[model samples]
Target chain A: MADAVSTPQEIETELRKVLSYLTGNADLIHADANKPFKELGIDSMMAIEIMAALEKELKIQLQERDLAKFTSIKETVETLLTYVR
Target chain B: MQALKLNKHEILKHVPHRPPFLFIDRVVDLRPGKSIQALFYLDPAADYFQGHFPNHHVMPGSLMLEALAQATCVLFDITYPSKRKRRFYAGSVKARFLKVVQPGCELELNSKVISMVSKGGVYDVWASINGMDVLRGEMGCMCVYE
Candidate 1:
C-alpha cells in the first residue's frame, strides 16, 4: 500500500507530481494551494489526466462527478484525505 | 467463442462514427464480452494535426481515449449482436498517455471488459504503435437507444 497521506500538506506534495506531468511545466504549478486548477490553466482534459494519475499513483478512485467539485488544490487535498488518511 | 477478425468496411456495421470522427480502422481480433484488438492508421493529413500542434503535431490524449472507447463499442456490439441498436457514450475515462503519437503512425488498440451492468460497463484499454505502449487505462460508459 502507498503511504497514508494524513495531512493536507502531504497531499499537496504528492499532487505536484501529477500536475507537473499534466502541464509539462513544473514551474507553472507553484501557485497558491487555494487557487483553482482552472485558474492555474488546467482545462477539462488536464483535469481528467490529474484524476487518472491520482487513481494510478495513489490508488484512490475518485468519482468522475466529484472532480469538478474539488476545483482547488486545497479542496482536492481535503477530499483525498477522506480516502487515504 | 474464438477471436474474430473484421475489415474496415465491416467495422462501419458495428460502429456509427463516420470519417474524420471515426478513429478505428480495422478489427484484428475480438472475443465478445472479453477483449478486442483493432488498428487505426493516423493519417498525416488529418485536420486535427494542423491545429493540435502545427509544429510538434502531437496527438491529443483525449482523442486517444476516444479511440479506446470506440473500440469498446465494437466489442459491445460483437458481444451482443442483438444489442447493436444501442448507442454507447463514453461516461468515464482513466488513462495515461505514456508516449507521443505522431501523424502517419499506425496504432494498435486493445480493450478488455472488466464488468458490465444493465446499461453500463467498464473496460480496460491500451494502445501501441510498433509494439510500444502509448496509452493505457480504464474506461466506462452507459448505453441508450438512438
Candidate 2:
C-alpha cells in the first residue's frame, strides 16, 4: 500500500508527478510538491482537466464517490490513491 | 492497418436502425478487451432534440444513456454472431452532467467494460469533445442472450 501522505516530502513528490501529467507541461514536474496547487495557482477547471487526464492515463475511472466533493491536486490525489488500491 | 472501424454501412448489420432514426455515426475504434470509441453528429432537427428542451435543444440524458447502451450492444454484436445476440437493458446508471451539449457538438462517446457476471455487465462511458469529457457515468445492464 502507498504509505499515507505522512511527509511533506512524499506529498510533494506525488503532487509533482500528478501535476506534470495533468498540465501537459512535462516541465512542471520539478515544482515543489509542498507548494499548494493554490500557490501554483491551479483553478478548478484546470484541476478537472487534470483529473480527466489522470482518469485516462491511470485506467482508473473516478466516479462520483471518487471526487471527494473537493477540488485540489493534493485532495484529489489522496482520494485517488485511497480508491486505487 | 486499423484493427476496428465500424462504419455506417456496417452499423446496419449490427443495429436495427436507419437514416434519421440512427443516432450514432460510427464506432471508430475498439479493443476487444471491451473498450470503444464512438461518434455522433447531432442534428438540431432530430426528433428527440426537438422537445427535450424546447429552447435549449440539449441532447436528452436518456439518449446519451442510450448511446452508451448501443455502444455496448455493438461490442456484443462484434463478439457474438447474430444467432447468439442477446437482449440487454439498463440496470442502473450513476451519471453526472458537467456541461451543456449544444445542437452541433460532434460528440465522441467512449466506454470500457469494467465488470461482468454470467448475465450482466457494467460499462464506464463518457461523453467528450475530441477527447475532453463532457458527461460521464457507469451503466449497468443485463446481457441476456436469446
Who wins the TM-score comparison? 1
A3-63, model 1: which lDDT tens digit per residue?
7756677788888767876677786557688887788877654555566567766777777
Instruction: Give one digit per residue, the lDDT tens place, for model 2 in B28-123.
Output: 897664778889988787887878888779887777778777777666566555566566666567789877787877888887877533344567
CAPRI category for model 1? incorrect
Instruction: List the global CA lDDT of all models.
Output: 0.79, 0.65
Off by over 4 Å in 1: A1-85
Q: Point out where model 2 deviates above 4 Å.
A: A1-85, B17-21
Give the Cα error of residue B48 in candidate 2, in Å: 2.1
Supply DockQ values for each candidate.
0.05, 0.02
Give native contacts recovered, as a fraction, per prediction. Answer: 0.00, 0.00
Model 1 over residues B1-146: C-alpha lDDT tens digits? 77899988999998889988999989999998789999999888899999999887988888888888889888888776664467777766778889889989899999986654335466789999998999989886666765
TM-score of decoy 1: 0.62
